[model samples]
Target: MTFEFTADDQLYQLAIVLVAGIIGGELVSRVHLPKVTGWICTGILLRGLEPYHASFSGLTTSAVSSFAPYMSFVLGYIAFTVGAALHFASLRNSGKRLGFLLVGEALVTPIVVMAVMYFIGGWLKPDEMTLRTSLILAAIGIAAAPGTTVLVVQETRARGILTRTLVAAVALIDMVAVGVFVFATAYLTGLGDASADWHEHWQHALVSVAIEFGAAFLVGTAAALIALGLTRTIVGPAFLGPTMVAVILGAWGAAVGFGYSGILACTFAGIMVSNIRHDTVRATGAYLHSIGGVLFAAFYTFAGMKLDFSLVLEAAALVGLYFLSRFVGKYVGAFAAMSLADVPTRVRNTLGLALLPHGGVAVGLILLVQENVHLQDIADTVTTVGLAALAINQLLGPSGTRFALTQAGEKGKDLPRLLDFLDEQHISVDVTGKNKEEVVRCLAAQLYATASRPSLPQEEFIQRVFEREQAASTCLSQGLMVPHAILDEGEAMTGILGISSEGLDLPTPDGRPVHAVLLLATPDTDRKRHLEVLAAFARTITRDLNLREQLYHARSAAHAYDVLHAEESEEFNYFIEDALTRAGAFSENKT
Candidate 1:
């Protein structure tokens, strides 16, 4: 259906999705699986079955389905973001040892899986198909879920040679798999008579990929320029959002609406925006991760809508066989690929387990080939890939990725770079607990050579802050907080952010939940430095809501510290100063 929407519907849908996806994504994702997985599950539970899955049906599904088209648009954009960023340098810098592991697993895993698929196909339908279909199906079956892989890695907060290289290999090869499928699909559609025409489709598709990639980059560049020029009171999130909409809606309209390849266009936009050295683009990305919550939620819900339960039962054999084939194929293929490249056994086993989760591309490819007249088997294969993928990938994907990182001894890794820097400098910052304490600690740390531990416990701090601020009114209301103590000499004008997923009891100046706590305290003498830091931090925090949101959910002290230091590094003081300061302090008791 056309997405020509009314103003109220637009507003309503937007509100629903944001509430469902962003706010809900955090809570449910932790309880269930990946954030994306949780979003889709939430969507389906709310939207898929009628009579509302109970009384609160409106709360769950009603909004999800209404915005399905926009969800498609957003997924097309996000999927591109997740898929498009493959580079040789990124992979290389990530590590050679990990690269060896991924390649090794990918190689060996496929061979084993394909052999099994061939046996299964031979047993089930020998006369109906040729050996080639079995082989192709077997190979296709081996395809790993790149999106799931990506989601899992992102969720684990892991970054390293192994993670980066694995993603690169998947992105690099999936297109080749698609090319092979197009050929196989063309042959299958000829009803056992394969044609060279399949080769032609790849040429067309690739040429399109090239042109679209280029054009989309230009489009994104122009878009970023326009965004950079904007200093109008637009919240930073609002700025990147409109820009993203322009990219997805303007160019993608021609593709998805016209039944052309919007996927390539979306991928191009995300790449150009992400790769460009511009603050607005980064601002836009931060906005995207936070603001597009609803669109993502709706997109997943609609994906659930596509599942045909009646058909699923009847085609159970194809379903079971396809998934079984895929599982075997991917596990072995990924392991072999990693092994041949001389990867470590520890990494190899992790990579093998890590490789099985699948999502976005498999679904897109399935959609691309679903309508062919002579491609019944191919259609069956597509269903096997998409549905089976949804099933298996969703279940083990996030957990497996988390397991991989933990096994590698990389738990609680930080995505924000600023926190790590502050850590090395020994900047004592309180990141655990409620927001106000963090804020107090941050400011307190900045002022003195000697660091003081946070005296207030999280709950007590939350209670006190709530007495002053009120419940759910996050200190992040204006995007920054500067709480100057009534006293002048005790703590050097402290500057720190309190943070928590379980929001503080502090009443917000604004009704939104508070996540980051920025405490600003200073002596009357250091007025200049206090105001200077305040102005800089406040301007940045106010502009980027997503930053506040991300910080609010940070699980570690390092991550919370990084949130502020990234934009304003000069303001943080996280260490013990020279020896004289401590020695001189003895005068207080001696006097």
Candidate 2:
């Protein structure tokens, strides 16, 4: 028996691509590399195999080429999601320093890259070097891979000023890159036509640019409105995924039909939706996240399939130059920008490193150059150098981003264990209280008595804890309650762990009697530390049912403390050390 396949069978091709991508992603994730890198690598491997085996002939290449339209939709969706990071409310809270840093990096990166590339272009390819080509290279170099940055941020569960600033800056960088590319393309067109009237050419270029931007904005706005309306009327949660897909497709089709940027259009739509119809955006976000994984895998896999090994080899010198120049430019520009903005030392030092990923947006810009008839003379050179540099950046970018996040101390760490924050005086085995207020008050009294100087009034402290409980119950599932409040003049965090043998009548969501109650009092100025303590407690007790039971059955406070200490992780120790240092309670012996 003989089996055969035809190029027209796109479903078969898609299945093969998705399966390969899934396997590759899993493999790379195991090694701590970005899943996107793995998907791209899989595509490249499949492409490489085409020449050796007749069975593999044209499948990878043909599938990628045929899937071009769908890829555009995926790109638009990615851009839109990225745009949501630019929520105005979030931006306002980020302050003017963040804005300055973003502008500084966006402007400096391209200029630095352009200057370096201009000087090196002569040696790399003197015959092809031209002012127009150099300008194009610089414009394309402005884009950084938001997808990779987002993936790393999500994987690490990073949260802090640095993470917020990095995300916002990435959104702004791509927007600025698109604007720069448009203007550069116009200038390049005028350069190619010296005989044409300068004023007329410029006027036409300006008009064309305006039309593209206007059309894109209009398309985005329309799509957003439709999606928002659908979300309001749609009852089933399952429809949300299809609704987002439809909106992305519509925006992409309109942008393509009108000779506009699908990315810009979808991004604008996302921004509008996020800001104006926030509920709709939030509802769709979960659905999009689930579906987006497979789409991104397929999109990147196809991107890898298009990689030209021969072009990469031919343009090796130019590619290396581009990589080095862009890398230096991003770091220097981010550092200088942050310094000028007077950003925190951690942000200034790490933001540049985090922004190293460069590919998706740059690839889109280069594709524009390749498809433009007016730039045909320099298209081959641009594509070869651009793709080669992009390949290198994609391979190395995620690691750089992860390193920066880790070093900045924003990546999720094991917080100080609940027991680590308490001592013999602060732990009570028999916490007797009839209600939530009495239980919380009892814990707070224990913490106050243990303090070196109990300057804070007992009544006032109890009142604040009640205020926090009123705002939101801290009761968690698995019989745990972590109530926390800020101390007015506290120098450090004080914790009290109380285990109740008989369940308290605390109104927990699960309605299970609370077996363990951990109360924390943190310095009013240190909101981050307070959250860290609560998070640590929630993570520990909720995940381990047996541990909760062990605490409930402990004969004494010391035994309960031992149970938690035994579960201490390296991350938790680091968190405790850092917290203690901030609280002025750390000593050399603790290490």
Candidate 3:
């Protein structure tokens, strides 16, 4: 059973976990469960099999620790995307109910858990560390893994108010958890030392907390600017990919190096990028998301492998108590707050269920607590209980989230997006024209030649675009124009992308020559869909200067199509499709 953990063995175990995770995920998905559940279960199974293969089963806690850096990157990426969801425009009018719901769940979950654990923990453990453990656990209680919740949402194809709210809520609560944990741990650092002055310690803890958050915020903001500058300057994905990864990892590393919350810093960076340049966030996010499956699979599987069920047996009472108390606190707090906020009855009832998964953030917090010098005395007990409870939470959390989305009638509604209409055939590179009218006519002819001809004559399609253009210039600032029209008879939406690096002589409000012209034709019956498509295109192209630059410089129609269909741009597509569906824009499709 004794084996020297070598680098080779780590690689071997990594390969096994990845393959096993994919297989496990596939199996669980067949049985109608979240793939994350399967991945975690597979990790636990691998851990259980460790003694059977001493060298290969290096999936023990030590082996899992070796992958900590990789996991940090994955969590950072997830946090960044979650942060991007915190756009101010969306949250500004989300209403006081969302605010109250957030406060209710956030404040109530920890208070209730802390109260329950403090009193019950004293009765069960009867130790000096009981209060500290309760406080620490309660602090950790607020974090729900945005990564897991978002995966479930993505897996279920859920979109709507409930999904958006839940994702944002989980992300916000996690940041709150980080802040609370930092302060609580700081205050408790030397609290039990007889020689330490409690008053001075409290004062120092306050200063430490402020510095921790303030420095993290600065690190994140600086990271955001770096990302913006790179994307704005770096034109191609070949160089952009590595640069983005470096920026994200470097930001996380810097925060951690400074003894701050790396996750929070990444989250803040994402928020800044999302609000400042949504196109950049979406494009980068889509690229990251392309590889998210493997990263998440490895992460959750590693998480499962690190669990020691022996601790569960030893702290069965405490573990059971923590699990029940935390769940009750989350549900009651969410339901109560939503009710008070006058939220819809279904949301008020089920939103709490969606918040049940406390994955990476909670696990990270407990690990931090274990490593703290002041918290060392109770580390063993806390780890035993905390990990056990986390195992239970991770196992149930995804299912809870899936159930909530299903009940909310928001599942499987994210398909048939606006981007679905555009293909290589619909794109033309180096499109030339003497004026805006000539460009519109050429784009319309190309659209007809490549795709199905609409019931309306091709000339009329050109006329409609001209008519709409006359009403108000579709020219979005920064060399982009979206000339769209509603076709009287068309089964679905179709479009063409004309890349004119030389610039079209379109009369733009900003007076910039249009370098990219997006011609959109929507079925008259689905007029609202046209508006949504126009908005999506305008937002995406205008906000992402990198994408615009690449598209303009594209060498061929296929190249332009690739630039448009690149994975980095898919996040914005998903967001628009989901948001539009929720708004009833796509409820009544033309065909």
Candidate that beats the other on lDDT, 2 or 3, i.e. the better one: 3
Name the top TM-score candidate.
Answer: 3
How many times do residue backbones clash in model 1?
Answer: 58
lDDT of 3 by residue, 1-591 (tens): 896656457677777789999999999999999999999998888888887765545456666788889889988988888888887644533445567766875589889888888898779878733778888888888888898999999999986556767887877888778877887887887576668798877887778778877898899999888877877786565555555566579779999998888988988888888777766665676677777888888888988888776677888888888888888888998888767755445667788899899888888888887788878887787788888988888888899999998887668855665575665456777577888788888888777764244667898888888898889878788888888888765467788888887788777778888888888888878887677677777787778878878878776554464455444766555545466676585566643
Q: Score residue 523 of candidate 3 by CA lDDT.
A: 84
- Better lDDT candidate (1, 2): 2
* Pairs that clash in candidate 2: none
Error of 1 at 400 (Å): 2.3
Q: Rank the candidates by lDDT, best first.
A: 3, 2, 1
Cα TM-score per model: 0.55, 0.69, 0.70
Clashing pairs in 3: 283-568
RMSD of each: 16.9, 13.8, 13.8
Local accuracy of candidate 1 as per-residue lDDT tens digits, 307-404? 44444465466556666666665556556655565443555567655666655555666655566565555466555534654554555565767677
